[model samples]
Target: MINAESSAERTVAGPLRAAWGSRAEASALADVLLPPSTALPGFADPERWPPNALTRLASVLDLARSERGTPWPQPTASQYARFFRDGDGDRTDYETPVFDLDHRLTRAVLAALVSRDDDLLDEVADGVLLLCERSTWCWPAHEEHHRLRGAVVPDPDLPYLDLGAGVVAAQLAWLDHVLGDRLDVRWPGLRARVRREVRVRVLDPFTSRHDWHWLGLDGDVHNWCPWICGNVLVAALRLVDDPADRARIVADTVRAIDRYLAALPPDGSVDEGFEYWWNGACRALEALDLLEHATGGRLTAADVPVVRETVRFPRLMHLGGPWYVNLADARALPSGGQPWHVPQEWARRVGDRDVALHAAAQRSTAIPDTAELGRALRDLATPLPDHPAEPLVGSVWLPGTQVGLARATAGSTAGPTLVIKGGHNDENHNHNDVGSVIVAIDGVPVLVDAGRPTYTKQTFSADRYDIWTMQSSWHNVPEVRGTPQGTGRDHRARDVTVEDTADRFQVRLDLAPAYRVPALRSWWRTATLHRDRQRVTIEDSWDFADHGDSRSTLHYLLAGDVVRDGPGRLVVHPVSGARATLVAWNPSLASAALTVRELDDPLLRTVWGEKLTRLELRLPDPARGSLMIMVEVCA
Candidate 1:
């Protein structure tokens, strides 16, 4: 519901205005900015590190040793032109090399630091030189020149400061800060090349340009604001020796970050879902940490109210290990691509032990492969706490985002859990699923959301909803009069309410507003989780203006192998090690049919395998009727 006008009004003097308001504060911050020598951690000199920091980096050193002779994947011009030439948006062809180059540099730099080996210095110099030789660091999808002009390839003179560019800048900056002196000993002018490339590609454009949409000046901010700012801030602090330039970059980045913080829901719910929280909210928190460090505690994340509230978002949306309330474009199983250490540190700063534990658990469980060298270095250097990791155990209701999660027991994923959302269709990475619900049993999704498919040209274009995964019929919601939920902010749930008690938790909302059916009056939907019975129930009571050949259908996308037991009853077998569940509906009101939807996208196949089953309850007559569905774990 936030537009440019409203966001602009709030950005004038938002929550972070007190942190760095006037020119005096800006000058004070500049006066105390960390010098280039100590801007980042002393990975170059590990003797001053914490006791176990070097030990933790042993794996990275080994990885560096293992890939010592492997050939780096080199990107070609054809790969870069694939998008502009044929409308292909798959970024793996060109991005794989970018990632490989960064990873190689990161591993070599850390390995040399850990083992004090001069042999690895040659590989490090190669990475730095290779980065400097690249035509563009920006990903092809983010390359605006293709859309702005008819150019097929990036212009060497104009660098697009997108996420990929920011990531490379930070990577080069960190490595230079850590190994610049060492490189000078052998590679000579390579350090200067890195400095020049970073200045041109990331720092110069970031500071000089005012029209970049991600800056949030025009109130169109999302995860990109904090993510790019955080990375750009790293490059600025580490590479920019000029105090005034550093200060201006820091101040401008802070204002943009403040705009992002102001735009967040007060309850700290991320409509982009759990995956983006690390990139969006956690990145801002990391930026705050950098500011606090540079200013000697003048600015702290603890001073921000939204930071404290937003740190627990991942925990709130968690549905056991690797399973979250996968709404919007977020997948059910997270890629863990972002840095977990950032959120872990944020949780510790905000004094939330549960969230801290959850983040640390994520760090421990997921495979660590990141192109952000700053976060990667920090992840290796930071030590995890000495406690077991657990999911957010109990029920939570975030009224700001209108999301409610209910579980049968506290601190244990023993039974059923119900997650319901009553948000608009125009949310970030929005899917036309205004009144969708997810049912999880012991942390495994039974009645599921299909998440998202691999990104293509159609993913973010005008034809976005044409993708079946982005449609309402694929979600656990009702389609009235053969019309699916509409898209946009106006098409959203109405009169949403949540009630959490000892024996039961319930969410009530009217979803009629989400549809565009002229014959529809109101579709009142109630989803309840009975903790005592350990069952989840979804009831849709809809009213129609006329009975004239109108019919509505309730679509429930179920994961795993689905078997129809008999009329009005179906059983879902376990998928991906989760337990099975029984889905039962009233036969008197509607007939049931199961349709198998085969997964073709490689991305979706990773989570749901080759296929997913959709169970539809068809209301033969849709004048005024109700449909009730109950899902319970089978004994």
Candidate 2:
């Protein structure tokens, strides 16, 4: 656990302000920050970037060049009004066009810079002008004006700076920095228009407003604090010509980031899980990197201890290729929407060799296909050091979030791995899955946490838990008295503990707090992974107000093809290259039934094919108040 006093004292913004708040510091920053054209990549000369940079980035350039004549899609008024028409709202209608414009402009800039193609300049200018002419940069789902004032369309006068807005603003800022001079020579006043549009849409709204919830001025902060602020920071530093204004904007960003840093647990675990780490923690690292560079190493990650502590989180959570411990609403197979360079660079900065190599392994030779131009540019300029791609494997215990992963082997994917979680039900993108466990054999999941489906109107609404995927019944936990676990922070695990020894690793949790069962008094679950035996055991002992708690059922969501061996045992055939696992339980105490859940959601299909199986064990007479289940790999 992090010391309370140390956490109180560790403030990123406090030290930053003390060192760089003055006009002198701002001037120093301005002097050190090279002009966009002269900065990293040096306006795309072969001497500036790595020899393989252009060739690696050619895929993106070629795609954009092929689509040069394609007109940018525009969201209709009806499409923008879909949110009010539906309860949850459709974000794709707004995001599809906005992000397409972002991608096109980013590609045009990269192509022009790399190939020095004059034809691409016109495409770049057209993309920028069209973006400026758009109704609003903010996604309909994120527009507060609609909820606050019942306005169907975005208020032109009120520019809401959201994730989309910040991204667009940064895109324009980077493009201008690199291609502004050339645009000035060919297309008069175009660069000025880009500056005007960005300042009005993102910068003015960002600095002038204190009420934006994402700023974290009043209360709780999440990924948005760092993700949005990081983008805005890039825009401010590059486009805001005045040193005083730039300093003030950067100062606000620093303080905002402090809230996010303060919220991080002692172990640097993201309760939101592995997928959001890219947007939340990685963005914070990028922000710090920018600060370090702009200040000439005056402010560094060394100032913040948590930065080093959290840098290895993604690496720690990895369970081989395309499989992560999908704890929350994150997909099992991440879309890789964000670039890998962010973590690679962060690992390099913090001297984490294992994490750096892991990040390098995920890195595509091509410039990452992301809307964030800043990320792509930095990735293009920096060459990844040669290292064998190997995932760190063994055992990891994140006490802050009460998550544990135990493997049968130290550094090889030759045996089964067991993962368990004991967090509250109200975690970010939460699933009611306290005291849930996942077992993977040879790096592929057998007993799985069935990750969430595609987002729709209800994903974030009051009816969020109504979705079956968000309920405890669909997870790998027991439903007490025919009732699943409840939602909220109060619905959480208690007395969680982890024990690690040379021969075994185990985790224990009092899971009664996670459910609201009238007859339930206590439910203690202990999951142990015996290393030499390559076996995992789950022992649940419970006492209830009523001794006959016969209604409770233990649920296990299984991936791969399942074959019933008998009433007490099931043989699981892994979907891919993983070995099969055998699940066994006490047949005298309970009876087993299998149900297939056909997955129709596009996102879920990507990870678990056409269907997954849910195995339910109904306790015939829970009067004994104890049950033991064993899962072992079948050679």
Candidate 3:
């Protein structure tokens, strides 16, 4: 994709500026750029701002000027070595501090722009150099993978670049744009080094590849495509002073963004769940916002219909509580609900006032990590509009993906809400469970998805299913014999049907193929939510032929505490105090017992903050038969 360009390229792209030159482009982007005398959000005094987002971030650099004058301890490679050896790349102590390097850099940039504090900028100079001088801004685990798993086994000895390369390059670019002059006069060598490093490391390598797994080279490139590319573009437009180089970067962006848009599901769904929906879409939006701002909307991708439709994904996927139909590594609830920046940005673009209010109300929740300074800059410049709440009612079924979301009502607090998933196990960050179901009474989630557990070496390896959370045995699905659902594209639901009406919603899925068990002849499940009765029914029909002797156990994963009155009946109490009675019965099965399983892990502790529980209903295997489970919300 990066070769010699012709005269046509020069004439057409015309300096990568869809409009060109900083003055006019900045003029066109008057609404978005930081206004004169504009103070950054939470920058006034910075003493009483929200402690977590900025104030606490400022604490890392001893910016709070609170008590101790100590700065954040710098990170080392040894800090990440053990985590890589343990196969947990993301959890190392190096993660947060390394991330804070950017956090501090962003703060410094904000200080330069809003407060014009030379004293604050002086304090942050060492931090930027600390990051820029590192061999790679990426984690050691990524470096480990690069060392071990290159296509030729360590043959490509080039610098290992992952998501961090783009992150650092982009941040540095913005840092330069906002205060390059100050840096030039005070620290010329450091300012020049930043540009030189971005070009030598990120730009040169990025434009060279068209299909690097992170680039939308093959199948659906996950968040990394836009997350990395978008930031790189921001870096290029901000730092690369040469018009030809900038034009080349823009050409690469056109190719990259086109692929990114192409890979998005037409229904605007992310199989990785809404947590990823926020990460992936929000990062992509960052790129889109930059493009519109830089090119004056001349080189915009928003006209792509799927691009516009993706705005609804966060709202559409938000089940009343922290609950989401989340598949993959995503929890049923998120660390923080979808960031307000997402909905706020999309609301104005999509002209949905309901979403605008949703974002405005949600903005104060948590600030984003990547483009925090950029988001803060925009918030101070063009804040979210005040809009009235609009009802969010509807059943959305994406036929292509076999995911169904049925809201109780747009705003109802007392009704049965059902979310069912029947997709293949090959999805990104997938769990082996295909025919999984989650039911909630009002906003209280009764049955749940055992989300993801603490990731280890086995988390991404061939032994992923060995972990309980990644298997069907721990999900709201049936385990045939001892065989839970298998992973990969082949083991998936078949002949799925979704029927939604004003009164009731039904989704039927065949789970026979999902199980690799030889004894499993056939399995079908029909999950119906009777809104009128506020009841949810999960009907399963199993045919085992002679293999009926194989023990069959089904599970109902619940978020809250569980109480069992009998083998056939159990009561689920979501933390919100809402309760639902689950009754399982079959004509052939004479005796059944409900057993519980629990897990304690660090990640689980943070996500759920309690012991995770799953009720396993053990039953006698009939020659062939059906089982019906009814969940009735107590009046």
Candidate 4:
């Protein structure tokens, strides 16, 4: 837990101001030089303070300082060091090369100051300043070395003047030392130029692209790009004093917010995944706060409910732990990374303690001292009894609509009763395992859907896509004879059938036919909490007019240390440790393997890789038949 005294001391209402005040005059000057459109709207209003935001902010600041100071077991220096290393040509292996360590340290120092730990703040500030000076010398030369080697060194020519890095450096310098008379005399001008350059090079280009071609645009399916870009603009606007440009910036930002918010389904389902939820959601909220502060509540009437609902999306979708693995490109689960602060900050702002608690609960490792704050937020944010259930399904269902089914049984210790998905391949960060079901009996996963593999080149290439795990060959349906079960451009599950009885529950889902194949249909019948055991049976019926003599097979490949009883039956031992069971089958007598070659589709190869291995269950008979798998849970 964070020290109370430290948090109390660092109680500055607006931390950004403290960090950037030294350049106020120069910013004022730049504002005069720039056109009116460059300035953000409402730059002159008194700064708006977060109502309760400072409390958690102070706690986070104190905890970060404590963690940095204590010799708590650190990851191997190599692990920390690898982030600074050069990327191999593989797109999957690429890491953001630039490390804003000085910025990070500065933020830590500022956080410490917020916590009222002046001594610690002073110490951190000194280290950060020194690192900043040294990094300026090291990064440029290092990057040049790589550029000479024909590597895809980012912004190679502008080595010494990377915009994002410069912004962090400038903010740190201004916070630690006053400009003009206080610091080196040239510091003020240098700071202004850095701010201007960042705006011109990075901010301007990125924003202009949004206006001009919209080709390089990040899809609006989720909120990350616009929010990040807006924040950058806000920073640039803060540095300039020109009222006209400030207004333009404000208007543009508001427009972006409106467009991005439109993408959210009214029910607040963010299919893009949680990583982006935090990234985009936090930035948007911050932008709104900043806008309102500058405009003296001119934007006060903005859609507060939408903002609230947007924030709530992550909470509803949170499966367990700190991870939310939804849609494509999501890692198997959420990681306790930097974004955890978002919920905490929001909880404080809205005076809702439960949201804060939710954030704290997610940090499984090195629980922060701010758990109390989280608990408070959770309590306040708890929904009222009459609150309606937010719709979870979208309206994009095709010939076969996507369906999710689950049943929670009484006296069932099994984790999830049953969780099933019948939809097109997840497009964002998808795997080839569509029409897959992950079942957990009494909190234990029995029939499982194998999660993603690596994100590097090996998995992104064509070689992996040909594999059953990355293709339709290993799934629970029929595969076209010669052609692969290509990704569906318009894939969805429809014709849903669900029934629940006192003793059992059943759900059946139909998926769209595979690509280039005659209209094919398949469905799965799952009987949950049966008399003694659970059963999942799948049936596939296909009529291929163009393709003759095509055979279908069911595929189920087992992984880990499972004892195979026979080709038809396998019993897993209780002693062996496993988290879930992976079940996949093709009823069309298709060839199946644990791993196969990659395919040619760029998107498929990019996500699932060229070579892949997954548990496959292939049906031998395709005519008038059904495949059934029964899992008996050992309580």
- Among these predicted structures, which one has the highest TM-score? 1
- What TM-scores do the predictions have? 0.95, 0.93, 0.85, 0.61
Taken over the whole model, the C-alpha lDDT of each candidate is 0.82, 0.80, 0.65, 0.42
Window of ten residues with lowest summed lDDT in model 3: 33-42
Cα miss at 38, model 4 (Å)? 19
- lDDT by residue (455-551, candidate 4, tens digit) is 4444444455644345655543444444445664455445666665655555565543444545344433343435334444444444333334555
What are the clashing pairs of model 2?
A: 88-457
lDDT (Cα, tens digit) per residue for candidate 1, span 324-404: 888888888876556777778878777888888887877753225443667766776667566574856689998877888
Tens-digit lDDT track of model 2 for 468-570: 8888999999988788899999999999888999899999999998887767788899999999798999988877876653478899999889998877899
**Residue 539, model 4, lDDT:** 43
Candidate 3 local lDDT, 380-431, one digit each (tens): 3444344445345467887656788776565654677788999899988888
RMSD of each: 2.5, 3.7, 5.9, 11.8
Show model 2 residue runs off by greater than 4 Å. Answer: 1-46, 548-550
